[model samples]
Target: EDRLLPLSVEISEIEALGGPLLLHSWREGIDDVDNDGEADEWEYSIMREITPMKENGTVKIDFPSLELVANGEFGKVSLYITGTDLAGHPVLNGGAPGVDNDMATLVTQDDLPTTISQPSISLDRWGNNLLVGQIHEFSFSLTDDNGIGSIDNISIALAPGDSRGDIWLDPLSRELSVNDNSPIHPVGLVIDELAAGSYKVKIQFRLGVDSPQSWNTSTQKPSVIVTEHGQVLELGSNSLSHLEWTVDGRVNLMLLSADDLSPPHSELFGNTLYLQPDDRFNFSGQLHHPANGLNVILDGDWQVNFSMDDNQNNAENWYTILSDSSSFMATSEIPQSRWNHGSATVQATIVGGVQTIPITDMKLHIVIDSTPPQLDFPVTTLSTINSNQMMQQLVTIRVNEAGGMGQNPLELHWSFRRHGVEISNMHGAAQLPLATDAEGLWTYSTRIDFDVNSDLLLPGDDLVIWVVGADLAGHPLEGIGTEGNSKMTQLRVIYFQPVLSELTVSPYQPTIESVFTIDGRVLNEGNDMGVVKVGLWAWQSSGNGGRYHILNETNLTLLPQQHAFFTFSQEAWDSGDLQLYIAINDDDTNLTSVPVGLVREQTTGEILWQNIDSPAAVGLMILLISVVLMVVTAAIRRSDEEWDDMDEEEIPPPPPWAPDEWPEGAGPPPEILTQSTSLLEEE
Candidate 1:
């Protein structure tokens, strides 16, 4: 059975003793799958991952099971325990000799790493002829089944020019050899120390193997094409932070490599930046500068500036920023007052020690606004108008500015909604560009009409009409009132009927042969129907002065609240009395034919108005006329008898009804005969 053991060795012999680590104590990446502080029994599993690098010295990794990643470019690599973390440096089975190198575990645990089934080596750059005194860089990648685990020693094994050195090699690059007692050179360089002749180099390195103190001395002759001149590196195009970088020009910029480090850290690719009000802007990027014939880093102080085309006076504004140190970081902020309340195109230009580049495609926008319009509706005058008679009443509207931005003439709109429903149904729409009168109010002479055939309006329907106003900036009236804008009072169309009243006639007292005029008014108390016809007539004495006759008749038309006048001139053919009457046809709506009468005598003073729709007065007037005719006949006989001297003898006996048979002392032989001597009645 295996048991734990304690061991110790000088730090200088650590490299040699770690060759058989699987047989001795530890072999790098051995771990405890279960957490217990002490190493757990575990077997090594081979993994290969192409870890990405930033601009620092180390790379961060999420998991060690990178068994699926293909070989990609990277820098220095180390080993890690599956469940073990490098914390307070607890000695694992006995601590690794190098405190700073605890991540390089080889002489601690007893788990053996998997052997390299296939070996491969790759070179990213080379030149057959190189500048004599120049420091040339070569990126050589080595691989085995378990990967180059925490490289312990790297040496050169040349057959001809060996260590004791018959030929010289650049000590700068040769320093990558494990022969040096210092740290390893990550970006190994080869200084030309040999003569201008061909030479062979076989590089061998030792790292963690399957057993403790057991090592694999893998060897490879990396192709070295050192050039005196003429060598080009093709790094096509790349993009970062919304800016596209084209490295095809004579002065192209490339992103070399990056690693994990602390603040002042740099990135080969720029960082994403988001800008907003009251927030500082922070951004960064690192790029490789180009030389005439060398693929190398150009490091120096850089000037970064930002410009916004949409800002006010933008042509004179430029913001200077900083990107200092090897890990360059260009950072700046946008002032709150600098916002233009509009979209703009932004650009950031980085002036490196050797070149200048303008990054395009940055867009931003800003805005600050809030408020509504003020409105007031005043009282109108014209009222008591008939329904459907055009609500043509005077209306007053007043408005103020919107959002404190002065009057909104160009952006204003108006609408008239009824009962809080469809405006179109009410024959209305949102008329844009504000329709206002000279006083800035909407003086709309509103009229309501309904076609009983197709319109939706109904009589006596309570219709609420509203006039709404708004601005293009989305400012509607405040509270808009409960009913909104303007409302209509109760209005309804109704039936019309003519009612006549207030009759007047000129010349209340008239003389014979004089003229008189009669006047009356007709009112449409209901909905208007049409004109009304009023006829005028009168009763007067006949030419014989014995009976009354209807004469002087005429007609007139009157509208609602209109006056009908009748003018007539009469000559007194003989002394008599007259009666005048007026009437309207009773067949039409609200029409009546009650005759109005007036009585006047040619010799009397006053005129009398009497309603005469009876036959009693007609019978009395006929009796009086008969008495006058009898008297006239008696007189005519007397005149004839006197003229011819034989009338009374020849004449027949008087009728008993005649006054002639009365006693001589009778009252003046009947008053009618005395009154009717020779005069006739006039009307």
Candidate 2:
């Protein structure tokens, strides 16, 4: 019977191994599928199977081989074990199943890793033709199949004569090779080197591998292209394979690489720039110096400076690439002259760089305004005595333009003064009823009334109407400063009614010393009655007979339909034949006075005078007065009664009524019967 035996190898032989064996050992990887600390039994199976020679009848086995992976990477490897039984039949206890079943019988436990896989490479540059000073970086990663080893001991070499080969690799990238010395694993690498020649870089490297007995090796090759200094690598219009540039004249400015380019953290290699004839200037505010307030202006050449936190600090700095300030024409005009107002960019380059960058599209804005409205109106007086009263005038304000005009409602500042003396300030809107209309060609007006007793307003009184318009934007338009302010208009409220005529006093020719009463009447003969104000004073004329004067004016309510009365005492009259003068104002334009015949009243009862008259004349006057009285009486009586008083029979009363005269079979009429009989019995 066969029994299992403990197996092991001397540690010294492991170190003495060399060449392929050592390389194989180094390449071999460890695996522990179940996470146990100890190596899996299957790991020693391969070594045990590598037994002694058949003639010696000694069993022998070779070490299992694997590869290394980078740090933190998983590695893996697989092996087949075969053997024969004593009867000469192949030993089959855990042999792989038939082709159809193809199941693996060997088992493993623990987390040990197995084989290492080569890393991939990525190359990038900002522009075509990498310059000597410009560093190009190539990136790659190493990986493995199992969890055991690391990428330690991997050596990356650059084939000489290559542009990338002539430069130094980043130290950090070099350190990726020595991460783990245990077994097969992967590593990440970056090469940041550049030279002055176009090159096809071949990245060659050897990585650590592992075996059940010792160590092993694995190698890989990755390649990329690079350019030498001063070489113009022209990326075709559509080809982003190379770096891009913005070139104007001899200067070149590199556009960031299409691959792996981000703005906030993006790096810039050069500062001086130029514009190329073929490329369009496309710039965005983001690329411009930040403090410029994002505004840039391109006058002849470019005169706009970036704004600093303080404008005084940075305003003077200007950017002009090619032509002198006076010679260069602005390529484009945005909504506003300011570039910051618009999205814009420059297709430019650094002198001799011959590179171009596409400036993304940028934006511009424009802004118009108008003056406030003006007001003008006439001044007039409204007279109560005058039949035609003045209506309030409407006020309006006009604007020149819609924009920039304050869009608010109009407010009026109105004042009235007489004889250069200040009066009340009646301030109000032209929009409401108290004033007048607010629209139309700008003008505001309201009626002014004057009392007869009040200080009479004469011509030349200053009447001014003024206003300013405020827009919705709260901007007020001022005509005050410009030729526009007609500002104030002057006018007078005139009394334009005609004078009174035909003035007569009840008692004419009053005594020189007696207190004679006089009643006067005046008629408006002209177009209007400006006013009928009376003044009384005693006076005497030596030759023309004593004249009667006004003593006091009587207060009376004058209605529009008829004349208004004013009574004055004729007392203290010192005159021969009292002559009365009645003054009536037609208007500011006309004033007329009517003369009355004189009457000499010697006694109180004879103030009107008793003249000798014929009986015929008295009778005629009496008849006329009586006839007038009778007609008036009849008219008043006719108006008092609402209905006619005819009898019920004459009027043909309602259906139940009886007639006085019976027709054939009919009963007596209601007047004739007089409640003598009932037609129907009471219920």
Candidate 3:
């Protein structure tokens, strides 16, 4: 068993022996978790009782209970008792005598007369209108003849009601002696979250037992009138008193003139208003208080201004104070020259009493675009379409507006006219698709179908087209047309068929071996430009009703009202009567044929005739001529024999009777004999 000695020493005597009494390694198996080579985990405390050969127990120090009582000229004075133990811990139930809790208590001394005065209330802005849902501060001074320390509990209540629970006080009640060093104690009370109503503040004070007094009941109570936010209140000829009051809220603004079919077109998207320059616009607004649900009137005037920088000092005057009413209406216009593009701020300022307040909620952001959208037709004026065939042409228009085109759809208006007369059934408007390029330029394009069947457009018919739309700022498109004077583009419908005329073959009566040229003129009768194919064809008269064959073909490109001459050459072979003509665009010209008796030489002295009506009669005529030639040759032979027998000298006279140079129709036709003699000489 370990031996321990009992010792009793005063704290001053222990400090005089040394600075302090300290023990090391007071407990075994104490771990130094921090590895600092010290047993710091064990708790060190002064022991109230000593123990040996056993585990140490918790030590507690008890302090003596205290009670305080005072009697003053005011009455049995109220006292608040509070103290801490030797270890600086708060004493439980440490208050005035006979109190079960720690709260301050009042002493009972019925023999003394009460001398404490009631609290005097001094509101921050007394008799002034208070705004609902806002915090209002007021103070009350408590006094006593003996000092404010003699006063104890204070209670505050609202007369009529506190049922809605909308009103709240920061410090609900004052307990005990709030200020013991001062003769008067001023307590500030903050009233917050108050609803709209009228009430009287009732204050009660307690200096001793049965010493409670009501301040409002003893004097004339000042009423606290809480008004709805934004509700205007009369200042009661005390303008100086309103200097301490705050005027705050917002303004709800709207544009009254923004509508369809009006100048100065405007559109509102969220909080921003887009505007286009025109003549003028009407603006209206009403004052709104956020604290309460009400539209309130301004006590003074309302002014409006427009600024590019959102600063009132740099803003331009838009509207002056014309009325003192809460709601306002004004007319204003933005000049095109002054504001061509970009944004501006429209601010409203309220002049109330002697204070000028700018309502941030009243400011509206406006995007002004004064520049009108420009229109351009890439394929403009004098376009042609074929009426004979169906075709689709892309009509494109370029729109140049810096403010961009709005989300509204664009329309293409077109009208069809024939001979300067409008065709009602062919005129209408259609939505056009828009596209944007890398350069930020917008273009609208639509494919227009031009069909004679569907459109009923004939040659010389004109179609006019234009675009109509507005930009983001509601600026209308200007000069949007395909032609001059901002009018529409005219697309003329025309037929591209080619007409052939003046068909003529060289040497109208052609021989079988002759090369004949067929010449003709191709004219484009329609108001269209294209290639026209012209073909040369020949028809030979045979037993079987004339066989047709194409001789030659050529392509000729012709413009509207333009003519081109085409020629084709072909070797006419084995032809009796040949009909030749020029064909163009699926149409034929007048037929021209080669007549008979146009002869061509096959071999020397061999004749081939073209366009012969009878071949057997020609063969009989050849046989008769052959028989006459034989008889003449026989007579010439006999005459030659007789002449030979007569005399050799007589041969000179026989020269005049040359058989080769006979008269016409002797031996053969004179032309044939001469052609044979000439052919023999060339051979």
Candidate 4:
């Protein structure tokens, strides 16, 4: 072991090295701080004192200046001593307290490296896949260096694992050299050679050492997926996670699983699927097949990968397949033909089973020519309809046969007649415009005027407007005999004849009940034939010889000069002379006929309704008389008995006494009581 040497620094020299050096004695109570955990300002001044070597080269030296070192930090002091002419001696060897060597320097550095980071990895699905030559693409990124620095060549080895697919590169570079150091590596990725089956594609980036500070990333790897042909599909609108496409006919489909080593399992989106016999590139459009047709399968929800390769030389062609099972690819070379209808089969691959859905036999007939004709209304009824009451409202008629309803060459001829009279003599064929609907649908309205008199009324003359139209083939789809054009309506017309409809009597007859049947008829002179109901009236002459009294009414319906009989209760009146008045009215026609006189058949009942009163009176009189007679007889009998009780003499004597009692001067002779003399003589 070598002897210890004393180190010191001159105060002036300390100031030269950036700043003053801190120095302090090794003694106790050398508190350089205010006790506030911080060095006092004065402590800084003490640092200016850099100790030097003592008298001799050999001396006892202590590094007491260490106290001036910063707190919570370490301080290092190197010793550089210059020996005076004398050689430096070992301490305790009769040397001075300090020995100076050469100069000393201290250096420090802040913020040293501590921790290292690992890059992150991510994965996502490329869009959908194509049917035959489909390309499976994936995007990859990383956060940590693989081995030593940023990865450069990303060599992806996609082994179908168990899937079957031919990897393909479509016009783009397959070997991705991501050494450009962009924030986002390889903006795009495309995987070719995809087959039907589950796959485990291993992706590794060839790491390149770009900088001495670059980290090694040889161990970091990315993940990619390539689905099979028919097993995978994409539903354009639905967010289905899994989709399976089933093929039909001479073709079959197989599901190719994603690379097993890939981070995320491969999924087939079903909602993005669009299967049509038409172009596969256009997904959100209607597909029409003239020949082999198209088919589509809608799997509920299940991840399915597909693979297919077919060269059917039919009109139907196969477009791209979707990523999920919800949609599939149709591989047909059939073009749009002139078939009335075509059919196709759509198959869906499901977890538990598979579905084969058949398309329509053929698409609907689409009229390609959209040329529509214009329609004007010289006589056409306005879209706004109004209620009219006057003679059948006569709306003028006009039609431009040329520019009518469709692009196909067509002609129209029309004729109008009112009340069986053809009125087209004035303005026969008024030219009109084409239909208003852009679709070119034929346009005709119920706007005919039969009566020339009333604008607010429907023509009453049984007006008829005849229309005749013919196609380019001379196939007339109009006219009276046309399958669909002949229509008829009654113009402002009326039932000219009148028929008695109803005639009824009040209270029915009381004593003699009778019902009379009145038959009558009327002629129908109107252009339109219809039923007319007419009412009749009857009046009877009172027995008092006064004017005739109304009795009852009858009604009947007459059909064009036809007659009818109406009968009502004749029991309403007694037999008497009655005048018959016939009134006929057509309710629907709103026309009333004049009252006509009809011969009255006399109805007679000798026993008027009042006969009931006479019988009742006779009965009451007989009962009164009987009662009075019985009372009178009882009184007479009583009186006779009383008389018998009294003597006859008493009665006679009472009468003579009254005569003699007459005033004395009034009677010259008084009749004597002869009853007593006669009784004496007889005795």
Candidate 5:
């Protein structure tokens, strides 16, 4: 048999067969169906009485199933209908074993999708607030069709358009490089140690096949919100979200009264504030109250108010100062009874929620010292400083101690007064440094200078300045005006400042024996006229430091801006630098000069320095030359005397008479002739 006979049975009856129905299947080649090595044969089983066929003549059989993990070989599978209740049943065989009818395609989970789009990026924490020095971490969560390749960049900037910040970063991939084979998609941002302020965070992303510009964030949501550590800071992606940070320390502030609108804070007083009439001021600085425990708000805005009493006698006239809530004024309204009179006291109380705190030692006492403040100045010390800096008027003002940094009620209010009123706008109200004394009084001192339009001071017209002793509150020191020791007013005598100009030497670099002229003009740089001396002087830089003489001078009275010229002549001196100088108004006082120098004489001159025109130096040279000439003349006379001695005279007499032997015959005749001539000459 071929083992391929056709078989048919009732579909309903065959499906009821729950037992295993064996098929007579056989293979030609070896197939390890059971996973064991060798090939095996199938056992043939009987036929079954199945249900009858339907209209299409298709029989259905319910065959019990068995699960198998064997790998079937590509061999033939046959079925035969044998003896049974329903005989001649043919069981058909399939073309091949272990083959699926419908083909399947491979699918990968990580591969990029057909259509690419932008990734949705965001932070894990929605809250973005933090402490000033605290470090925190958040994530840049991203989701896309191709997954995240990398984060291109991230940056932080101050909110409200402040670009000066610390959070600028590039390629914030957070180790998400393609080469490392590590799964890096979500980028984490770790913020550490930020200055307390409002800041914003932004970022860009890199996805496969898409540039950062092409990435889409139309569907991104704001998630991160940072808070609790300090101020509330919100963190959002794709858009701007700011972080509000605050420091942990407390803050300081100051508030003045109604009249003084500008807050002096620590500029005037340490812990207390001084107020004048109609003064209105404000307080602006860091403020904080220590937290009692966890979950307590340390930074609380409290309602503060100022109260004052008419007298230190503990009277019942305490009144609240009425002021604008936005102003730095500690009080809303100051009762006239407190500040209008002297010797009044004031304090401030703060109401923070249910807690009330009264700060003490913030005393405001009225001042009433009848005597004006005394001004002391060492005239000699002040005169040496640059008069031009003092506006050509020497003035050293020291307000008598008003309790040093802490001005008590008895302090002096020293100021420049004009037209019977204090000139508060002197150089735009300059702030001077404070000096502390042993008596615990603080004083302020300064120099006044009005550079322009100083022609205001006429002759003998005193520049009036006032020094009044008063408390911070409006009371002035009262005293009888004394003639010489008047405490309240000081009159400075303005002297005309003589400024020497046009200072020059005719021959700038003078040669030896050459005459040079020193010319200068004196101009009164000050307001009034005074007697000023203009002089020409020279410094011989020959090992002399201060030894210089004024060769010429002229005393003259110069009015303001009026000038006069004085000139002098002198012969050039010294080969080295000759300091030729001219000055005005420097007689018997600190000298100032415009000096010119002459190069030292080298070739035309000798080694020593000399006013080449000076007769003493020339005479010394002539005397030495004369002495050398006299010595040479004496030597010549001695030589002449020696030459005369060497000459031979007609030494005839001795020789003719004494010679007897060699020229015996001629000797007698020569001797007779010599004796005859000698006798004749003698006679």
Candidate 6:
């Protein structure tokens, strides 16, 4: 049976027919009819012959293999010949063996050459250095005689160790087709997001049904280095520098002020800064990459007078008021009127550029106080005390400083003087430390003790007291005094003839029935002879009223600065409560001593009697008495019931009582006999 071959068939299927399938051209006209080793006109024979292991007797056509070549451009690649024909001669310009001229043409997938050029890659921005957070385009190009349609697909991937491993190019792989008749084809991939790092981009292309091959540029693999935008370069004390691109070099600007300086001299309280009038306000910082080589300009309310220094001599040091080249520093005293406005702002800019760029800005609420601390003396200016006795007075002064409290230490200066001369032996011009009560307040309270006695102060002498203070900014105290001539008060020393100085009372918690002793000492605290009557007195309060009665009296005579002791005792007779004290009285003065003893009525008894006032104890005692009475009543009732229950026969005869056992009148009463006679009658 004869079979016809299909339009398309696999080589293996053709071989299953038991032999090679061959085709020959046939014509009615006779010309080289047998296709035997001859060349003739009008010939009908096989177009080409295949010979196994030997050269054939017919002409053969051999296709040239292709390889990739750099076109010395960014994104273009060229295809050239690499394989030769059977004669060991190179096939020039993608032509067959018979063709003499070079030409480019498109071919089908089945007619494609063995090898083709890979794609060349290029980036649209910054060559290989890319910035993060920006969109970039990568172009892939190829030049092949097989035309653009020969390419099946294009793929892009990132190398290992890349941070964006999960990211894949959109469409994963591109299926490219011919849009035009051009031999050179270009494809693009847009990457809109990428992480900040160095990455190697890999590109691949497949011609027709061939395996994918790697693609790269001429010098290196397609790569990119991504960096962060607007990166901070350096940080200094109270300043910062940022990197930014400009028409000039990269610009780095930093600003500084007294508010942000180290070892700060200004104080801030509730959004307002406090400063002294004499303090210097410093404004300084550095400026880098200035446009047109112009000096930095101040644009706001702050009129800074900047002075530049030669930076060549001090290149290793940071820019300050003393040295720098690209920096500015101004030291000026701020006016008090300007600082009183409650707030201020400073702004700087580089003005010589095409467009003004802001360098730095700072705003602060400032308060410059020229007035010193205010002092208000709350106690009397003059005080009087005896020569022998010591008197202490609390000198409280209310200080209202401009800034607040607890900023600095306040000093109290005191001195002793006789007439107009200061006594060097005594406490002269000494400082007393002060402590504040709280923080962040306008006023503070401090107290000092002023002692007046003969040891440091003589009769008719004076003790001078004053206060001095300063704020953190070195502002001195006001209203009270200056450091050299301070305002002060004097304490007067006088003569007190005799006084009951020390008094004692034995048994502080005394009972009403116990005797208490009152002892005292009379001192002559004057320069003249003194005589006084010392007496012990007791006072008791009653429902009617209260009165003091003299218990004992004694007369004493004391020389100047001499003291004597006196003792007295009194028997406690009155109940309730009483007070015992010693009193010294003279013709013109009467003085009472301290620590008067208080006596209360105390009852002597057992523990229960002592605690009789407690409700729990009283309740327990009543319960016990009720229990005893109930027991006695129950016993009596039981005895009566037994007596009544007994019959006259059960009573029997009373025990025989001998005459000797019955004492004269102590025998059983008549009631017993009457009961026995009644019982006998009943029986």
Query: In the order shown, what is each candidate's alpha-carbon RMSD?
Result: 24.6, 31.3, 26.0, 29.2, 30.1, 31.4
lDDT of 3 by residue, 1-683 (tens): 11121222222211112122221111111222353433232321123322122222332223222222222222221122233323333333423322232233333222311221123344342233323212344434322232222222232222112221112222224231222321112223323222222122332221110111231122212322212111222212111222233223223433333332245355655456667654355556665545453554443344544333434235565555535455666656656666656777766654433322234346556667667788876655224444443345666777887666755557867677888787757776667677654353687777755433433677666766666777767777777472243454445455675766566667665667677666778778877789977776766567887766777788999998999997777776765544555556535444434233344545443343332325886787789999999999999999999888887654343335456667875555323222235766888
The segments of candidate 2 whose C-alpha lies over 4 angstroms from its true place after superposition are: 1-402, 407-498, 513-517, 523-535, 540-550, 565-683
Estimated TM-score for each candidate: 0.23, 0.23, 0.32, 0.23, 0.26, 0.28
lDDT of model 1 at position 78: 27
Off by over 4 Å in 3: 1-273, 277-366, 377-396, 415-430, 437-441, 445-464, 480-484, 487-621, 649-683
Tell how far residue 465 is off in model 2, in angstroms.
8.0
lDDT of 5 by residue, 124-201 (tens): 221332211112333333232322222222333222232222233433233312222211112233332122221223
Winning model by lDDT:
3
What is the Cα-based TM-score of model 1? 0.23
Query: Candidate 2: worst 10 consecutive residues by lDDT?
Result: 19-28
Q: What is the lDDT of residue 391 in candidate 3?
A: 46
Whole-structure CA lDDT of model 3: 0.46
The superposed Cα distance between candidate 4 and the true structure at residue 16, in angstroms, equals 58
Instruction: Return the clash pairs for model 3, or none.
Output: 576-611
Worst 10 residues of 1 by lDDT: 207-216
lDDT of 6: 0.42
Question: Best-fitting candidate, measured by TM-score?
Answer: 3
**Model 2 clash tally?**
132
Models ranked on lDDT: 3, 6, 5, 1, 2, 4
Candidate 6 regions off by >4 Å?
1-280, 283-329, 335-365, 370-373, 380-393, 400-406, 428-441, 449-454, 471-475, 480-683
lDDT of 6 by residue, 510-602 (tens): 666677677788889877676778876666577888766777889888887999988777666765445555667732234364364555667
Clashes (N, CA, C under 3 Å) per candidate = 39, 132, 1, 154, 55, 0
lDDT of 1 at 26: 23
